[model samples]
Target: MDDIRNIYCVGRNYRLHAQELGNEVPKSPMIFSKPTHALVETTGQEIVLPGNRGEVHYEAEFVIHISKPYKPGMKVEDVVDQFALGIDFTLRDVQSELKKKGHPWLLAKGFPNSAIITKFRAFPGVEACKEVDFSLIRNGQEVQRGNIQDMLFDLETIILFCSQHFGIGAGDIIYTGTPAGVGPVTDGDRLQLKWGEEILGECFIRLG
Candidate 1:
């Protein structure tokens, strides 16, 4: 995980997720970013966050790892080397305020441990990915599940957009967006991330 460079994220890439958050569905990819220091691996250990924040919501996503420098015409399968399930932990209240003020989301999205990911596995190609379902399990109950086929902006579109506008390259990872069931996570919550039926990673939450 330490080798990761840029952390790019797409917001409201799922139509239902936009509606659930009272946000309009974007016509194009909604790009955002978190600093690299926000990353923490899901090693079944306790990860801590600010307890005083109003609410910390978990947005589970499909994380894509770029293997080589991106080129405009390259396919996702050609550039991507691995994939994993990850959580984009948000300070929801802070984000709401930022949105209202028309400000950047850095304060809400870039806190320590805000970006959590499971171990990466070899990329299985785009079609193979669309056939699998990834999910977030909280306290042993599934809270969010998603498949790549449902994304408003698919992998190719996202990669191209990021590469064209922001410049993607090796060591950058994209958090491809989450599904509709996002909600607040409290301290002591055990969160598990799964790809298909295999549990990729799990961790306990601790608020300080």
Candidate 2:
């Protein structure tokens, strides 16, 4: 996690997710952020959840690992090709209240241990990322499944849009958003993120 400089997240970037959450599809991308310190080092450790933050939801996302320094004027094709699988944990109830008050989701979104990711790998190509199947399973049950075909904005578009707004730099990561079927995670739940038959990452939930 220390390798990442900034964490940029795109909210409701899947049509089904936006509809299920009753959020209107944005004309452009809806972006938010989490602090790099919020990243939990899970190399060989189980994830310990922050207590008393309301119901925390598990959102599986395709994480893009930037290979080079990026600025606003950069083109999408200039981005490096590394990627990974990860979970963007959200305090759903907290986010709801913040949304109602028309407030930014800093606390609700950027709390400690919110960003969990697997090791990065070279992205095969656009056709591969676009067609690859990914899913999130909790306690041995598949909960969220998505493919790049369903993304409202493809990978290049997401990176380009985010760079324009956030001034992405080297080692920055962009979470391209989650699919539908996101729900609360409880204590003792074992979570696994998979791409096809291969398990990309796993995190054990230990809530106090």
Candidate 3:
């Protein structure tokens, strides 16, 4: 079995999502982890759940794919050369329950297809900056909107922090975290994750 590397998530990345989660203006970015298998690719694929959580919530997060390994004392600029982005889906109900018990949100965050992502193509001339407009349309109605600029932690910071614990190497993908307005996804439902004019990708829900 492929040993899952790491599931890094950012909290209160988006101001609006922070408000929706009832969080105060954060002093620093809150981070967490899900299982590796939780990842889902949005390129013409479907999301299938393991039924561990009651409601599989969707969080449209900006993902990062590391292009190379980082050396110790590496500055953000050093690894800034390699940054890719994607989405991080969540399980709200299970996450909430775990919070009540002061538990780890492993099960809630790490389920099959819990993390939805698109291919990582180099984003150039953006100053390690991102301008994104993301929404998940269910039944043809826009349900979520997240802009990358709204993220509390930018690519540099996220990559810097990530390297502290893990050696970011080639093919290492990071789901930056989500924006607010998260909701449930059911079987037979189709989801669209779009970034501005380009459609990042889409996925359908299939119940087992």
Number of the predicted model whose lDDT against the real structure is largest: 1
Clashing residue pair totals per candidate (backbone < 3 A): 0, 0, 7
Residue lDDT tens for model 2, 3-98: 788889999999999999899998888889999877764463588876687899899998887878666565555776688888899889999999
Q: For all the candidates, what are their Cα RMSDs to the real structure?
A: 0.6, 1.8, 3.1
Off by over 4 Å in 1: none
* TM-score of decoy 2: 0.93
CA lDDT scores, all candidates in order: 0.96, 0.84, 0.66
lDDT of 3 at 62: 64
Each prediction's TM-score versus the true structure: 0.99, 0.93, 0.82
* Tens digits of per-residue lDDT for model 1, 1-208: 8789999999999999999999999999999999999999999999998889789999999999999888767889999999999999999999999999999999999999999999999999999998899999999999999999999999999999999998988999999999999999998999999999999999999999
Q: Cα lDDT for residue 47, model 1?
A: 97
Model 2 lDDT vs. the true structure? 0.84
**TM-score of candidate 1 against the unseen true structure:** 0.99
Poorest 10 consecutive residues by lDDT, candidate 3: 76-85
lDDT of 3 by residue, 1-208 (tens): 1323565777777777778777676776677776667765566666676445577667776665555677766654454333333556667777788888989877677777667666655654234345556666776778877666777887667777777765566556666667777777778888776666567677787765
TM-score-superior candidate, 2 or 3: 2
